[model samples]
Target chain A: MLLLVLELAGTAVFAASGALAAVRARLDVFGVVVLGMTTALGGGVIRDVLLDVSPPTTLRDWRYLLVPAITSLAVFWYHPQVARLRRAVLLADAAGLGLFTTAGTTTALALGAPVYTACLIGMTTGIGGGALRDVLLREIPMVLRKEIYALAALAGAAVVALGDRLQLPAGPVSVVGSALVITIRVLALWRRWHAPVARGLDG
Target chain B: MLLLVLELAGTAVFAASGALAAVRARLDVFGVVVLGMTTALGGGVIRDVLLDVSPPTTLRDWRYLLVPAITSLAVFWYHPQVARLRRAVLLADAAGLGLFTTAGTTTALALGAPVYTACLIGMTTGIGGGALRDVLLREIPMVLRKEIYALAALAGAAVVALGDRLQLPAGPVSVVGSALVITIRVLALWRRWHAPVARGLDG
Candidate 1:
């Protein structure tokens, strides 16, 4: 029940972000909804596909589908208020990132994936939706170029993997992992942290 | 055997196109190879995942993995010559699109997907790799903005689906379907056909 609630909340916030991006791009209503849903669900779908889950959980579960659709439509109708809450949205996005990374790593471990592969899948789950959104919007993926986004995901995933290896209790381990991700992301944002670019490009 | 050969050839040409793009962007060697492999195998991986094939054929099969890796490396070394052969690469991409569409549709139908779903999946398979490539390079997808790319894939997929419904011979139907895709693509290129953009956005 807790997991379901967290997932739904994550989906809602991600949908809001995607819908806002679509509005900024001046896409029509249909486009806004499509982009929003894609951003909300793309990561989970990719994770499920990698795990060989047919029809994906999101595709089969009406609740999973509904949250993003409703959220996107809501953003479409009341974007001005939502845009004013950009800081709130970013914080929600950070929480979503944390939740998704832990969920993905835990799921992959349960499915008997190797530790390293599970970590990578978890990171992909946290970052994949945003990457897809940027691609559709014709922008460089923020995870690749800006901030400490992907690293935060990776750090959280590694914590999960380490906990699994040490035979730690799954519930507490997951909580810690997700909290670490959220904390790191928030700190990075507050500090304006960025990863280094390649050296000597101009030369 | 023939399918394997054709898929490998398609992978090679697609890798070449991706590598050329990376070179033009002045990405490093690692980035060039990563982009190339992503372009070559992304469509098939996506098709397989949607069809519930575990680990994807491209991921599990050594031959499938080897083809793209080698092709990408070759393109990395010989990009100037490959760029000079741009026309040839375009023609090859048309052929690859046809092959992937037919293969994806056939696979989906064999799995008992609905007809419309199969057609859409086929179109996705045809265009997914190029879309991924463009996304990585931060460009609007060519299928969305340029010539009759996705439409041609859809037409060929429709042909395959139609033939299946009519109980036509599989081998000959596949040939005809792929030929139609290639012909339409080449004609679109030759005649400079383009889909219409949305109107009155300037106002």
Candidate 2:
């Protein structure tokens, strides 16, 4: 299904971004790989736990582990090449954000979560790992600081929910949904769009 | 009840450990406190969310936030004195491990988890935050590597289960359970005990 493709791509890209952050922080190889794995799998693990499913999908499908591990080593070995394409990496991360947010919302709905809780879970699933990672690194999260992060995820999830309510076909809806998210995120990045913080950035 | 007192003490001690780790990781004052709060409260949050309890205890109780924040500041300011009494700190941590494991098991039972699952969850609650904190700091987690960490938690949880079956007085059972955990952990530390890895430390 189109959903599977989007999920796979999104997982790899998100893992790449997390591993990249760990490398930038000068973490060891195992640490880099660990961060990558968690970034790829953390959201889904939280979802399964919330949904009370044992032996979660990530564990059931060990492909989930292998993907991030391979990709992180590739990133680590090709550090110079990756560094030159930092902008491209960010765009891929945006793609990942959109993919994950929509998938999270869809998963919650399938599991019969109420709409509002579904939305919150989707947002948490999209951003929780990155937030945790950034907090540990002692820097403001990239999501917190830049590129209309949560907004883009929220928009994508809302669109997915709307499409489902309209009884749209799963394939076309996923394509359109992901495209919409990627387009919005890329434009936001290009325009340097930022959130309006409390009291006009008075914090 | 005495059991409740021990659980509260364990929470406080674990929060202190998180604050201390943050200090070593060079977090600023507010950051230190938040890290401590997260470490102390995260496992319980996971437990509640898994049990489908909305908003978690940390959000419901003001004390959960206040306790860690105040303790973090106090510990940060008094690290020099605290460091000088390392043995006492270890003893406190061992006692905390038993207390948290027991509390986690009890909560899981209250929520109708099976006995085995309760025990597993109790161990997770006792060690999860520390594991997360280590990963954040880019270090191998001590809970996973050093001492008889999970085993100690397991033993204490077993004691609680046995105590309930025997209808022992809560006060006496808690004291015996805590003392058992501390003794095992202390012995493990004194003897440089480690889990036998299949690969014999090839990492």
Candidate 3:
């Protein structure tokens, strides 16, 4: 099905970002692989665990594991050239984020989640893996620190919600909604954009 | 009441180990506290989440949060002395591992977990935080790859199983089991003891 292909593509792109992050950390082959694998599968694992779905998805489907492994190998072997393509990599990651957020939240909603909970799960699905990867890397998580990161997920999720409300076919809704997220995210990163903040914490 | 005290002591020691580990990682004050909190509470978080207990212990009880914070501040101030007391820190950590393993498995067994699963959880409870810490540090997990780590938990859990078979009081049995684990771990570390297959892998 198209959904399966979308899932694998999203996972592979996410894994590349994870591997790229690891290279910046000067991690070896093993650490890079671990980072990539965890980033690729972490959101779904958290989703499954929170949902109390025993024997989480990563365990049930071998593709979930294989996608990350293959991606990691590709990144490791071609890192120098790949690093040069940061813009391409970031764009791919944005696409992955949009797709994953749509798929994960929509699935949760269909599985009987309340709308609010579904929204949270959608955001989590979009950002949870990267957050875990950053935390393990001992860096402040992008999900928390980057204002636009989770906000993009929220925007896509709202579009998905409106589409569902209007009884639109999922295919069209998914593409449009995911595009919104990708555009917002890429623009934010490229522009070094940040949300408005009232600074001045007491020292 | 006595069991409560023992649990607090174990948590404190676990928090201390986390602080020590984070210090080595060169984290700042807030990072040290966060790492310590994770070290102390991470195992229980995993257990509760897996068991579908809402909100987990750290949220339910303020002590879990504050204890690690206080421990972190102490470490921040007296880091030099703490460095000189590495042997003592190791001993305390060993003691914590033994106690947590017995206590964690006992709780699981009480909640009607299968004996083998309880034992597995017990081992995880003992070392899960450390594994997470290392993962965040992007290091090979000390608990997984090296040391007399999970083995100590297995030994204590086996003791608890035997004690249950003999209809021993759970409290005394837990203490004895924990003592056994601590003894084994201390002796192993002190004697430069090791697991089999310490040979170098193919490079």
Candidate 4:
């Protein structure tokens, strides 16, 4: 139940980011909805496809589709307010990163993916939507350049995988693991942490 | 057997395009290979996923993975020659578009997806990889703006779907449909046939 709530919350936040991106790009209303839905659901769909699950849970479930669509609509109509919530959006995005990474790791492990595959899937799930969003808007994916984002997700996924291997209770493990990711991401933002760049190149 | 051969041919051409794009971007060796592989296999994987086939055929089969990897290696080494083959690349890409669109539509029909869904899937298979490649390079997808590119693929897919509805043989239908798409695409390029632009806006 807690996992389910976390998943929905993550989707909503990701949808907001996607909608904002679409608005910035001056996309039509239809484009905004398309981008938002893709951002919220594309990662999970990619994971399910990799795992060989049919029909993608997001496509099959009405609630999953509805959440992102409604959220995008809200953004379309309330741009000024949504735009003003920059700090809140960042915090929400960090929370989403934590939730999605752990959830993806646990789901992939349950589906028999190897630990490494699970970790990759987790990171993909956390960052894939935003990547898709940026790509649709013709921009470089922020995850590839942003400070410590994908790395934070990977760490969270690793925690979940380790906890599962040790037969830890899933609930506590997920909470602690997600919290660790959130803490890392928030601190990275505050500290202006950045991944190393290739020297003597225009990054 | 024929389908498999056609699929691999199309994948090779797409991989070449992707590798060329990576070289133009001045990406490192690993990045070039990654882009090439994504362009070659990404479309089919996406179609399979949407059709609910798990593990994507490209991921499951070693040959599918190898074809792109090899093609990318060749491109990385012979980029100057490859770049000079722009005309040849255009011809090959048209062939790929036709083959993939028909193949994708047929596969989706065999999977019991609705005709409309199958048509969309076919177009996706034909264009999805290139769109992904462009997005990764931080550019607007050519399919959305290029001269009747996606429309040509859609027309071919529709032909295949119609033939299937009339109980035609899959082999002949595939050949005829793919040929039609290639002819249309090539003609569009030669004659400068383009979709109408929305006037009075920054297109």
lDDT tens readout by residue for model 4, A30-90? 9999999999998888777678767778789888899999999999999789999987888
- TM-score: model 3, chain A: 0.93
Cα lDDT for residue A106, candidate 3: 78
Q: What CAPRI grade goes to candidate 4?
A: incorrect
TM-score, model 2 to reference? 0.61
| Candidate lDDT values, in order | 0.83, 0.72, 0.78, 0.84
Q: Clashing pairs in model 3?
A: A136-B136
User: What DockQ does candidate 4 score?
Assistant: 0.16
Per-residue lDDT of model 2, residues B53-157, tens digit only: 678875687777677678778879997777676777777778777777777766666666656656656766676667766766676565534537766887887
Clash pairs, model 4 backbone = A52-B54, A52-B55
| Top-lDDT structure, candidate number | 4
Q: What's the interface RMS deviation of candidate 4?
A: 5.5
For each candidate, report its DockQ versus the true two-chain complex: 0.16, 0.08, 0.09, 0.16
Chain A only: list TM-scores of all candidates: 0.95, 0.91, 0.93, 0.95
User: lDDT by residue for model 2 over A1-203, one digit each (tens)?
Assistant: 66787788888888888778766766555556656766787777777776666534653465666787798777766766777789988888878777777778778878888777776777777776676556555667777787577877777777777877787865676667667778888998898776766685654
Candidate 3's residue-wise lDDT over B1-203, tens digit each?
Answer: 67767877777877888888888989998888888888888887776664456788655888777777798779877888997998988888888788888987787677666566567567667777777777766765655344467667789998887787688899999999999999988898889876532112222
For each candidate, what TM-score against the reference?
A: 0.61, 0.61, 0.62, 0.63
Note the B-chain TM-score for every model.
0.94, 0.88, 0.93, 0.96
Per-residue lDDT of B52-156 in model 1, one digit per residue for the tens? 776566655666657777887777677667777888889989998988888889888889999999999998988999988887888888788766898899999
